[model samples]
Target: MPGPVSNDQFFARVGELLEENKKAGHGSVFFTQKRLTPSNVQNAEDKDPLWDVNLPGPFAVLIRATNGKSKENRDDKIKVSTVVQPESSEEFFKQYADVCKAGMQALKPKDRSKRKKKKAKKRKGPVDGEKKP
Candidate 1:
């Protein structure tokens, strides 16, 4: 008899695939667990490995470009799409690395100073409120 596949194994497989697509020059990639459908929930007792816990059926991954562009401008920009599928650990990792690389490229850090300025402004008392003596 075959041993049951562990949850870690399943998650790792998905992560690996996303990473590969990122490295291949895609903008970004992410993995999410498949949700139970209304039909599945209605019929559920114990979790169904085929339909509930595993990767589920087909899904799409959207990778935005690194350059920040308005929605209209971005429409013309190239984006990457990944299709999820059953894959061995090794193959999955390859794909995951690619996706991760693209994600890294697309990520942009927020301006910390802008946030600090907003917080400081909020902390100020109203005009003619109280004065430090």
Candidate 2:
């Protein structure tokens, strides 16, 4: 989770994911947008992704959780994206790490100085050779 990410996008992805999972039976997820949309964005699904991992060309890495419904074993998953899914898990992790790192670098500290730029300065004595107020 990055600081300044879109709340709408986050919720949208989660909603689409749950919808896909619902459609795929027990615990599965499916793509909801075109295999390839310009800008890699779409109405609901493509705008955000669960795990980009490695999406070379018209591809994305979606996951399907298929574990015995229990509290302690929910991380189990199946790679669902196929168009350009990573060939190896190593690649998946690598891409995730990359996205996280980029997000971290993109964050910036908020500066209040910019918003409070109009500080009143004292008025100078009436002007050239004029009497003081």
What does the lDDT read for residue 89 in candidate 2?
A: 41
Tens-place lDDT digits, model 2, residues 89-118: 456456534533443332466777755553
Candidate 1's clash total is 24
Compared with the true structure, the alpha-carbon lDDT of candidate 1 equals 0.45
lDDT of 1 at 41: 41
Clashes of each: 24, 0
Give residue 3's error in model 2 in angstroms: 8.4
Q: Give the per-residue lDDT of model 1 (tens digit) for 1-133.
A: 2232343454444455445555666534333333224343444445664554454543323222223234787753332223334444356556556645544544676669998888777777553255653
Top model number, TM-score = 1
Identify the runs in model 1 with alpha carbons over 4 angstroms from their true place.
Answer: 1-5, 27-105, 113-133
